[model samples]
Target chain A: MEMIERYIYAVTQKLPQSQREDIGIELRGLIEDMIEERVGDGEVKKKDVEEVLIELGSPREMAIKYRGTKRYLIGPELYDSFLIVLKIVLISMFAGLGIVFVIQIIIDPVEILDHFVGLIVTLVTAIPQVVGWVTLVFALVDYYGGVQTKDLGLDKTWHPSMLSAIPDPRRRIKRSEPIVGIIFYVIVMVFFAFSSNFFGVYVFNDGGFREVVPFLNEAAFSQYMPLVLLLLAIFIVKECLKLISGKWTMKLVGYTVIINLLGMMVVSFLITGDAFWNPEFMSDLVKSGIVTEGSEGYQIGETIWKNSTRIIVILLLVGLVWDTIEGFIKARKK
Target chain B: MNEQEHIDKLMLELRRGTITIGVLSQLSVPQYGYSLVTLLNEKGVQVEPGTLYPLLRRLEKQGLLESLWDTNEARPRKYYKLSKMGNEVYEQLCKEWEGMVASLDHLIHTRKDEEDGND
Candidate 1:
């Protein structure tokens, strides 16, 4: 009887609140019936009850059968989508990290091994972190019985005519590419805005390698910081839009061309103003024996220093023209 | 893998689908979980008490079976019988089952004939 009570308790404990009492009473009656059938006119014994309970099987297993199907952290319905999202995130993480590792190696060729080792460590840690977070988000969505792919607005309004929305393979942008671009752009923007000294030439001086003499005049660059920030914001927005659409269209191309032209104009304005370069960088070059003061090398260096703004402006215009042409070409591609 | 295990697996699958019909057939009379199990086993349809009790509750919940608790004896017992809906459903299911068995029997015989001809 005690064993029966324990078994009933175990089974009922797993059941929903409203069904517990009814199920407990019903289970007890069934157990008593089985014991009565086994003992006949004899007094009911613990051993007889135990045997009946054993035949009934584990209380947890019985509870689960009553509960219909098993619960899952991520169920079958959302499993395909979960796997898709996980694959995209993991692959993007690896690719983005790989690109950064390559760029870091290029920037400091001496530390190539160190960068490679760091990349491996980052990938090892980041893969599981990304996978775990994605699983957790999917689990929460599943638990809440949130809307599925079939319930999407696109599914409701879907039509044969909308097949055009399926991007052409030739022109289609892989989503990870835009995401990686955005990440790279953000990193470059941050480095330039906060650590402008990193842009200059490194030289061994005094006892060890001294900080690079900054190429851009910090005070002068600070004045145009708002424009620089706006340009960065525009690039970020464009990349985000590209990621969302997963393909190029006329509108996106137009947007890219307009932003690039505006950026080129801003660069031209900064260059022509003659306040962009650090006046001190020329002296630092002479002191470092990079160029002899008043020598033929100094004359060439001076000429370069005076005409650098015009050279940069020409380069900016060329880049803008190339970008505009490339944009139209991509937009026109099948 | 072996012949006996293969047969057992096939039988398990066949029994899973037919157990509901077997239970419904015997529940025209009010029977408790253990009694229903005994009756089914006696009729050569073996059902575990674990499977039978939960199934009875599920059928009742689905409005196919109605239950009553009788405390007349020293111990109380919940007896289940088919509801009006249950009876109609059971009859329809029985007809469907008979049709399925007949069609399957004909298909099997036709296949057997082909195999015999080939041999």
Candidate 2:
């Protein structure tokens, strides 16, 4: 009897919560029936229970049979999308790091070896982290989403009306668009987040070694780092929505408009801040002997430096408006 | 793989679908898990209780079978019977099975006739 109880416990323990009680009861009755039939009016013995359980097979095997399908961390349904996301992330990471490496080499050629080493180190460290985070997110989605592949077609509950209409070929999004958008946005994010110093003037020293004078004030830049990263994250999310939908819809357009406007507002605020530019950038260029003070080159450089933030703000606003209009056009295409 | 192993593998595949029909055929009359196993085996359809129990649950989940606990019995046994939907599905399944068997029988006999004529 104890053996029977233990066997029932073993099988039912692996099943879903709602099934546990009913299956446990059903298994107990079935085992008792098997035992009774095997004994045939003889004294109930432990050997009879052992034989019944042995015939039923191992507990894990029984549980699997009940489950019907093998469980996965990221099941077959999401596995394709997971692979696509991983590829895009890896390619983007490599491309971003590559661009930073080139810029560093150009800015300070003497430190090219150091820049190459830095790129390798970043790649080695970041690849695993990216893969881990992506895998964890996909696994979480698979677990909580409760999406079954059978629900799409195999199940009798699925109906013809549930099927989506054939999408217009002209309206269908090219996979490359979102792929490129993701790669581009990620590169931009990484540039601002980690390689902002690379965007500046390079000068030759007396020893013929190149040196850089970055334009953004490091102290002020650090303050806006969190918001910059958030906007970039939102941009990546917008691209992901496009990738998932594979075509522009009203929902996608709404999301795009909202995200672009939000980004525009944040960019405008960051650009208008006086601390966003390095105050000594112009002075540093002249002191480095690259340009003479009061010369035409100096005057031009100063004017561009002063209006740089305003120009950036205008460009960003224009980009945001264009994106919103494009989204509306694509989504409303007949 | 050896011929015997290959044949056994193919046999398992062949029996998989037919097992559902076998189980459903006997479930028109309410039967507990062990009773269905015994009845199927007696009628020359070998089924393990372990296989039958899970399959019964799945069928019930699919709305093909209705189950109730018969507590009036000496021991409380979960009895399963065909639902209204189950009956219609089972009948359709039977007709399909007959059609398949008839075509297969014709194919086998025709091949044998040609072989005999050659011999």
Candidate 3:
């Protein structure tokens, strides 16, 4: 009896809950009728039930069969549409987070980016992220009818409906990646070289660098930034590609965003010059253990939240140009 | 049989079956799913549940069938019958089917006589 019930539940598992109980009962009756026709009625016991089910086929297959075919937009129909929306949303979310981070950075002890640049950056990041998320949700809902099971693992053949992802064609001819990578790399190298003490801008220029950097308060940020900025920008681009192309090849974009934001707290300390290590900040978090880095958590979150916004836009524009160029080149060849 | 032969059989039955006539004739009166299934079954043509359901859905989607959920009963069921457009299409199918049958029958019978003489 238990086996029979298990067999029935297994078949009905794929079906929606609303229909499961009734369908289960009706199907069991049908199965019983078929069993009776095959064997004597009530002669079959629990041991024979599994055999009957095996002959019928896998429960998942039966469930799929019973649910008559329905066309999916993400499958073959609106696959291109899905990619367009995913790009827009992922970029937008990044932008929104960046604005919030910038605001927090400014509000904190050290101020950077003259008021206009700061506000502009904040707004620029906020708008697209909001728009991207809105469109993404709307498009997803319209296509899937409010049933989405988007898996974001890095290793699988599982293509999200949006991931009929074709390889970008211009990867060969354009060679923009290397140049862009180096430019980004150079930016980090410059930041670290001057920010760190050895070739100190402040020491040499007698505080000339102080006037240029709107906010530079922490020693660690001063020390770590050259390495940090290069890493952050490259990571952002990688995350955006993963998201837009539906590659599942890395950590969740959210996780990356949060982790990178921690760099902001490191910067926040640079801005405030609040010592290399805040014992109270570290100890309370380590003691209360709510978080090992309490105030610093807000700082990282703020950084991520701010930079993500700009990074989102930069990623989208770069990705769009990259894809478009790749697409154009492929089209020319074809 | 080969695909061609199967298709020929299906086409022949469809031509002779008077579905255009049967459908249009029935649509003059409002009919629902179970009622329509019963009507076809009584006429000695059996429509499988899967085929009937999908066909009904497709027809409704195509604006050829107008349907509304009639939930007054203990179990809610959707009733479907032809739309105004479906009526016109049904008329067209009836005319086309008659013309096709007349031409095919004339050819077959004439060919049969020729073959008989040659034998």
Candidate 4:
């Protein structure tokens, strides 16, 4: 009886949550029937139970047979797109890293060997992080059904008439667009989350490359980290919508506009505020000799630095407008 | 790889479809999983309990069968019967199966005659 109970547990544990209880009950009854058939009026021995279980085959195989189909963390529906997005993101990471490496080597040729080693180390470390994050996002998107599952409420009964018309091929948003958007969002999110401390001014000296002036005030940046992460998450969700829809819709356009508006507000609040910027940035710039003191170049640089918040905000607005326009244009297509 | 193994593989494939029909045929009248297994085996269908249980569940999920737990029995037994839709489907499937059998029988008999002529 104990062995039978263990065997039932083994099979039912592998099954989905909803089916487990019913299946467990059915299995228990079935096994008991088989045991009775074998033993008749005699004692139900452990050997009879063992024989029955052995005939039923391994628990893993039984579970799989019951499942009817193989389960995936990122299921077959999203698997192809996941692979494509993964390849693109990894290649982009390599390219981005390579470009940065080249620029660094150019600045100070003496540290070429050290910089090459550093680049390799960075690539090695970053590859896992990138793969992990992409997989996590894709797995979550797969589990949650990407975009359409958001409004899948039990209150509304489905109708055949509610089925969307076949989209025009030309009107279909290319999958690469959303994939690239997701990749970009992931990269930005990763950079902000894990590597924000590297956002600093570096200068080479006798001590090798040193961060002479950190651009972000660590205390304040950490405080705003959650908000920054939230903004990126919303952006990723919007991109997920684009991925799932694979075509322009009014709903998607509206979502994109609202998300962009929300993002603009949050981002403006984050960057334009004193909490985000290093107060000593201008002084640090002068001290580092990247910007000179009391010269024509210095005067222009100073003026630009003084109104940098406005410039940054304007740039964000321009980007927001362009993105909104693009969404509307795509949605308007036949 | 070898003739026996090859034949066995083909034979398994052959039995797979027939097993579903066999199970559905007995299921016009409600029967519990173990009883259905026993009935099928007694008639020489030879389905594994492991295979039949899952197949029964799968058919139920497809709405070709409906199940109810009869707790009145000493041990609670889940009884399954052909649904209204299942009955219609089974009838249509039986027709198709008969057509296939007739066609195959003709083909096999003709092939045997050709082989005899060749000999």
Top model number, lDDT: 2
> How much lDDT does candidate 3 score?
0.52
> Against the true structure, candidate 4 has what lDDT?
0.82
lDDT of 2 by residue, A65-107 (tens): 8889756788877788778988998889888888888777767
Candidates ranked by DockQ: 2, 4, 1, 3
For model 4, the DockQ equals 0.77
Q: Judging by TM-score, tell me the better candidate of 2 and 4.
A: 2
Which DockQ values do the candidates obtain, in the order shown? 0.60, 0.80, 0.04, 0.77
- For model 4, which pairs clash? none
Give candidates' CA RMSD values in order: 9.6, 4.2, 17.9, 5.4
User: With candidate 3 superimposed using the best TM-score fit, by how many Å does residue B62's alpha carbon deviate from the native?
Assistant: 2.3
Clashing pairs in 2: none
Q: After superposition, how far is residue B24 of candidate 3 from its true place, in Å?
A: 4.3
Which residue pairs in candidate 1 have backbone atoms (N, alpha carbon, C) closer than 3 angstroms, thus clashing? Answer: none
| Off by more than 4 A, model 3 | A1-334, B1-24, B68-78
> What TM-scores result for chain A when each predicted structure is judged separately against the true chain A?
0.50, 0.74, 0.32, 0.72
Clashes of 4: 0
Compute the DockQ of candidate 2. Answer: 0.80
Give per-residue lDDT, candidate 2, residue A305: 80
lDDT of 4 by residue, A81-145 (tens): 67776786687677667656665665567889998998888888989987887788888877766
lDDT of 2 at A211: 68
Q: For each prediction, how big is the interface RMSD?
A: 1.2, 0.7, 6.9, 0.6
| Cα misplacement distance, residue B95 of candidate 1 (Å) | 0.8
| Per-residue lDDT of candidate 2, residues B54-106 (tens digit) | 99999999999999999998889899999999999999999999999999999
